[model samples]
Target chain A: MFESADLTILAGLLSRYLVVLQAQQALLNSCTHFYQLEPRLARWLLMTADRAYSADLYLPLILSVQQRTYNTADLYILRSLQVAGCSVHWQAANDKRKFF
Target chain B: MIKENFFEQNHLLREFPQDVQQRLFPLLELISLPLGKVLYESGDPSNFVYFPTDAIVSLLYVMESGASAQISMVGNDGVVGVSLFMGGESTTSRAVVQCAGSAYRLNGQRLKDEFNRHGMLLFLMLRYTQSLITQMAQTAVCNRHHSIDQQLCRWLLLSNDRMPGNDLHITQELIANMLGVRREGVTDAAGRLQRDGVIEYSRGKISILNRPQLEVLCCECYAVVRTETERLLPWVFQKGCTVKTTEASMSAAKAD
Candidate 1:
């Protein structure tokens, strides 16, 4: 439990974090329009890893891939990322996790 | 020179305080904007600010590869070339006429002078700019999260809100460019809407048949922009409603 003054300071820090996150998102959104898909995907993955504080990402790809058949393009992009030194491990049916 | 009453058609000009109207009106030039006309390219100096009476202007951010995506749109309810008073002489985005119609344009210097007056116009312009920023931010969010189908619904509703009628004279190719998606994606999404009887598309025209249904189909981004716009510029929407009521009564009187 935080004291009243401490809580106010924490709230202020959280709001500042939100503002920075929103600004970064807006910048990324515009930059994605200009940049190539490979670099953009790498940047996104790096950011995701940084935010999560973990190098490994467990993505449920099969379910989403089946729903959107067009994700073949996404798969190809991911493959390129793997070739670019980002290790990708695809798990089996029972354990639906794609580690990147 | 346009008639004095014509200014009222532009929500921004219509709601201007009486003194500001007097000072600003004479400087305005009524110009016809043709479809696909580029108002300004990226990094080009803004010479004039446009107050669209019936036209819609799309602010597009273009890439080095020539691909472009619309960041936001401006219609009668707001002004274009906001960078003039925002203290930026040039903008990175290009402004293009999305719909061909007439608009009143004021020289950028005159606008700056009025803004420097530190009066109602300053507050109004700041509020309008805030709403425009909200729209741009929401567009970024929508592009990342929403499906093409939901985006089309939001786009149609937003465009329809700006115009006086249901018809939108734009092609799927143009919309595809604006949304930064493939033409086939827009075609597929539009086909679904047409089959649902929410809209009718033929040639380059799309007529919205059910607005409520369109709203239902749209994502939350549309509502977010709308609420922000209404909150920032209450007089614009409120005065528009009152004007519509007055026009209805006038028509009824003529019939009687």
Candidate 2:
């Protein structure tokens, strides 16, 4: 288990791709309400990312799982990176960890 | 055709043939996206492709009782509605705005029309689709494993990247909903962070106090995700964006 501070910087670096660009207009314009849920999403992704070992291979595995489950490509690649990390640990370990 | 703006945001854009860029660019539109908005719902048909210029959107899976958890988030570095290019018209997840910003929204048909032209867009979207799937699978794994503190640390890190600061304006209750856990769980996690001097939370606001310490408490998931993102999406991170592994914490974790 790592300290929270180190994890924050690491997670932030991983998620830099999630920052929005300026000047682009939203078709639905629903960020404010969605923003309300960011903390939860962020925390979930963060927790998952912290558990996984490698992002490169892990990301591909995540994509594979979603491809099997969702059958659509409308997913967040960056966020999935975090999820892959978590899944690796969760599946690899038999113990039930109290996360997410 | 992928435009300069699109190319600038995505490194993969440069790998495309000029003709492909030209083919895809005309279809791209400059649009604005607001915060906390719903772009698509579970089972709703997708109608457009979104390339965020300055916004972040969350892909959420809402439970039957209205409880929801965010599966992922998209921003400038990516495009929304990859299913159009990936051969799907809809998905089970809902897209909502995680941050209040802007993005270019392209009509789903226009995007597909251009994609049918098929060259760079086809390949790029496919790779992107692969990346997105990775996140969803990882999410399921993380939710099932890891400690709450570790999870909180990972969450903070992801959010920190989307903004310019350590402070985030979000409520614990809202976070609980997103995590698909009870509000008390978030409160407890926040409380622990506060006690440890890792964060300062007041009302709905959270200020990261010690990033290194927070990372120390988290599992390897955060680093794995970040490293993968950097690898798959080159040009997104600057040179030598190393994952800092402090000596003190390594010893501490081992000792514990």
Candidate 3:
């Protein structure tokens, strides 16, 4: 589902947001499957990717396994993003789309 | 015999040519791999090759952001540091103790010296490496294609195969972390399995209640890896449930 363009965009997004080249690449390298993420997951990571230097922004998407439920940890990240004034749009792949 | 006592406890070490076995036994340092202990990290120099007698070590890739996922698992059927022999002085994955138990470790230099002789040990290690490769590749495929529920079954089966008992001391969160999935997904799947009596999960421990039912729920990936492992390492056996020991069984070789 991800591509090099997405990676370039992700790296650009992360680097520009974090402003640390070393940290950017390090986070990218650590997240082995960084570009192969669903759009929603990528956006979620990008939103939180700027919180300090803990740039595990692409982590949620790196593991090839698919998981559907949004647990407390997932909620915590989304909640953190919302509290920071970033409106979060969370959706599970199987859930029906809401117009709101 | 005192020095060689535990060699029999490890299938790989036991199958070694007597001359090679004699050379390695004294050098082997029997040690305990406590659960969650990080043995090596990505790009770290491996100083020793660990031969797990009962413990299971997971090879995981940790992201710079601290997220980690397992790539493969090593047990008594294999060695821990294949990158040492595969010409990479450092590995790209982290080795962690999954099922804490005993293992025999040999200094990397000594292993290299022994492997340089181009004998049965080297041949066996190479064969074992092939099986490890299959497992790593299969894990990648499984992670990419299988559902979290199916992956859990595979993980449980693989861990169960390495362990000496039916119970596993791991949490859904850890399993989710290893599978690179959401904890909620694991929680749900484990709950379903628990409800069906396939397993009993509580207090971060999962006990396999019905082995046959668990097998019925797993994907084909489990069988493929198990079969390939036995094919590559002819000595790898269908282990029966036994008491897991924390103490190093260095004297177990005497029984062989």
Using all chains and alpha carbons, the TM-scores for the candidates as numbered come to 0.73, 0.59, 0.69
lDDT of 3 by residue, A1-97 (tens): 7775675455345323322322233233324333333343444355556563665333344342122223323543333333222222433333333
Residue pairs clashing in model 3 are A30-B64, B5-B250, B5-B251, B5-B253, B6-B250, B8-B253
User: How many pairs of residues collide in model 2?
Assistant: 76
Q: What is the DockQ score of candidate 3, to 2 decimals?
A: 0.04
Query: Regarding DockQ, does 2 or 3 come out ahead?
Result: 3
Show pairs that collide, candidate 1: none
- Residue B140 in model 1: lDDT: 79
lDDT digits (tens) for residues B1-256 of candidate 2: 2235333443344445687766656665555465578888877888887876445677777655576776666754567776654445776668887755556566788766555554456556655655555555455555546666676777777666544446666777767755566788888998998999999998767899998998888777677766766666655455221222234432443343
Which regions of candidate 3 fall more than 4 Å away from where they truly are?
A: A1-34, A37-100, B1-5, B238-243, B246-256
Residue-level lDDT of model 3, residues B1-256, one tens digit each, is: 3355455556677778888877877777777788889888888898989988788898887766687778788876778887765445677688998877878888887877676666777678767766776777677667766788899999999887775778888878878878888899999999999999999988978999998888889998999998998888766675442544443343453332
**Tens digits of per-residue lDDT for model 2 on A1-100?**
8676675455344323222111011201122123433343444345446668743224344445654222212233234444445545565776344232
Candidate 2 C-alpha error for residue B244, in Å: 26
Measured against the true two-chain complex, the DockQ scores of the candidates, in the order shown, are 0.09, 0.02, 0.04
Among these predictions, the greatest DockQ belongs to 1
Name the best candidate (by lDDT): 1
Query: Where is model 1 chain B poorest over a 10-residue stretch in terms of lDDT?
Result: B241-250
